[model samples]
Target: MTSATRPQLEPRISSFRQNGMRTDALVLSEPGGKFKYKKITLRDNLLEPDECLVRIKATGICHTDLNFASKDRGQPENFPCVLGHEGAGTVIKVGSWVEDIAVGDEVIVTFTSCAQCRNCETGFPGYCDRWFKYNLGFSRFDGTQTIEDPKSKKPLKGHFFGQSSFAREIIVCETALVVIPAPTPAYELLAPLACGVMTGAGAMLNIVKPQPHQSVCVLGVGSVGLSAIMALKTLARPPRRIIALDILSSRLELAKKYGATHGINTTYQKDLMPTLMEITKGAGVDATIDCVGLPKVVEQIVHGTARRGRIVAVGVGLLTNAVSINTFEAVQAGLVYQGSLQGDSDPKRFLPWLLKMNQQGKFPYDELITTYHVEEVAEAIKDIKEGRTVKAVLLWDTH
Candidate 1:
């Protein structure tokens, strides 16, 4: 969308306080730079009329974090930005307009959106017209920034996913905070639900909606992929065959533990379509939830689906990337290829449900996580990029 037509957010930064609040944050200094855990200060008074201060207890490392951090140095969201979004924490304070959510309440932080938009009103907040402006602009919608270097007065951009949970403390908008009750679950177990885990589960159950007689395939059996597998298993009449595709054998095995009926290591097996068709016993896959958004992967699977099969893309890829579709094939084969964000989930309602399912042992999302101290950010990044960890949860107490 063009800037002229895009929604312009009103400046929402609160007034300046006599003293700024200081806290720890993993600051990305440049494109391809290492994450440095350091001190950052909130520029203005904490919390707008509809905002709250959250002391981040745990945050998950996601592919989107890596994708944005590797973005060019000159962009608004690049260079000296804070980037974690899958955050779970406690509300330390609330703004005047905030209700239901109070100080000391547990919460999960997720993407924010304009609540009045058509998409939001119609149960698709992830597609809100101002979604990019609010969640990805790296600042308050009105072009104002919330974070800055306390020492050198250096400029830093944050407000990522409305919380920028990479920091120890954050002033988050009410739209991004989903409150949980007392006797809260462990933050490590809840962090990923804010985005990664939630996306997979919601995509499988909410969007894909695989039936008992159908066959489903999940590409990239990482945390998100595994979540989809588990969600599929939760169905009283789940799909007949749940195929898990990944490059790593370990992750494939992990997918099986979460209910994947078949595991295929794509790294070793080059021809995927034939193998998938064979596994489905000559019937193409009925539903495909792509956790990997590579162009080639998408192109190949487009023809491996059954007539009327659904392919849902929930992977976080660069905006510049595009996947070409064969119009005739799509029409003739009765294919449905769609894009999704956060599994089109309303975090306020969906996360609580996921947590409930988790409590019942029906959705063991916590099993995918590998904890790392906030200070060990580098190691976590390395492991995730190298497939050593399905989900890395960073805790605040270490540093």
Candidate 2:
């Protein structure tokens, strides 16, 4: 799947006029290995009445997309899947049932939730009963697609994370939409907000909710960890000591810039727990977040957390990965362990709030961005995996 030999799956301009609706999409033909340029197919077609046809300007490439396209993870996606979850675009068309949204509206596509579910009513759609399919099942809530492969003329899944937006257009549910201020940088940053950034920041603001002068430790300063650092800075009353631990020295430096009061580079540190304890003056951190998700890393975090501190697991470890904690110690110390998804936020409110924070310079998340063209996706993923960059955004300029 070299770039030179990658297939050029183009949209049929003639088809745009044939249907009452006009939209384009990128389709993933297979998911057995790294998603090469060849897997993407761009096609213009009609979107359904229950959908909001969107003209995507920019989309974020995430590690999850890489993992979804890879065979290493179980439950491989059905081929010819549309593989993008984070998108910022203009609403070119709206469905009949959707009265709140009008054509030409700007939106940053976020989570997929069954709006009528009890969990959603309580503002926890990430746990929506139908979330398995609506978010990552790679299909619409009805298990259908509004886009198709022009050549085969076959139905393709178009609603990954409620918006499979790897192309110029996507059809999304109005309920899953998050309206953002126009001309914002969501074009570059929206994707991270959808998953990676949300997970990290949410853990801090939503789960841990650290108090003023409290101490906190963040493990693995990758995209998620850096976000936690950013969230800490924006806190109304920040933790007295924010410690960042990671194997990468470069990311640790970025962590410092993002508001980490102390950074422990694991490579140089003889023992991470001991170093963390010394930084906290033996009192230990009030809370610890394990953003790496590896069992060993999680164990270290468990060991480093303060006696009565909270430990939040924000990383996506392999399903087989497991961590052990002493029940007696946990009972005696009163440790709290929690697992959070998408920051435990209702995207409808959170994305807009985050955007406002960014605009106010309170959440200057732009520092994490390293942009790339869609073709550079592989390189971007490589950089992210090797810790050369925190986030990689894909700008689709095919007008």
Candidate 3:
């Protein structure tokens, strides 16, 4: 039946929920394809009791988003995807089961998780058992698609991190929401906090927890590494030294603004251990974070830290790359090697805290962000890939 002849959708939200509204999206028709702005359908399904309609005000480009949009790992779920996870917007409609949140509320959209998982129940949704299925599944957790291509009417993937907010508007899982309080923060500024900022800050505040006299080294001066520096520096009694290392001299200099006491341009520095030892006064770094995830960088950081120091890995490299840890050296040195996801954060608690800190001027992040119109997503992606922009935030033209 034609939409002109069908019964009128009841509520304003139903018009979008039932009949599949035409909306703006940066669509990737196939894995490794270029993202082009096009019209897409919002899908013709009723919103579940736990869902809500959101108009994306701002969304940040993440490495994960780009990686998935540009690669095909031979997964059946690959291709025809919309990929933006760090989303911030205003709620336009609510589901029957949702009570705490309401229309007109400003919100930050984050990843989804099954409430039944042990991790979820214990406040670590980042490690949820269904995390991959619900967040990275492209489709809904049940393998259903909420978005369709207008012409082909073929199902295109949405719900990347439960929001697929590369589009102008989206319907998201209630579990993925974190409401912003009155005196609301800027949506564009808060967007990256949904993931990258949270991941980096959480690693320091939650995992690293560097001591006042200890030394912390960050092996990448991207958004994540900078956030880690800012976070540890914001501590009441911060570590004695925070080292920032990156191939780009620009990024290494930018890290100094955040809190890094020493900046190392890895491209020019042939050996890091000598510099690390000199900076630590021969004690070596007490903690090291590998945000680059390259084998060489990881190995260098692993060997540069002092005995019994913590070595944390947060970067995502090639799927085929195996992180070969030298078991004997690790055991002999009493070093700890660990992998962290989303900075081991529970978004419900962590995001809000980050916001409060931001408001207090202790965790300033504006310096790292660069904004663009949603239509200029291509430019934003390119700038981030080339290291010209630390964080690319896309602003939707809602009108």
Clashes of each: 0, 1, 0
Model 3 clash pairs are: none
Local lDDT at 357 for model 3: 85
Off by over 4 Å in 3: 1-18, 72-77
TM accuracy, model 1: 0.94
After superposing all C-alphas onto the true structure, candidate 3 shows an RMSD in angstroms of: 6.0
In model 2, what is the error at residue 233, expressed in angstroms? 2.1
lDDT of each: 0.84, 0.74, 0.83
lDDT per residue as tens, model 3, 67-91? 7776544243666778889999999
Best by TM-score: 1
**Candidate 2 Cα misplacement greater than 4 A, ranges:** 1-27, 36-49, 268-270
| Candidate 2 lowest-lDDT run of ten | 1-10
Give the better candidate number (1 or 2) by TM-score.
1
Candidate 2: clashing pairs of residues? 29-80
Better of 1 and 3 by TM-score: 1
The C-alpha RMSD in Å for every predicted model, in order, reads: 3.9, 7.7, 6.0
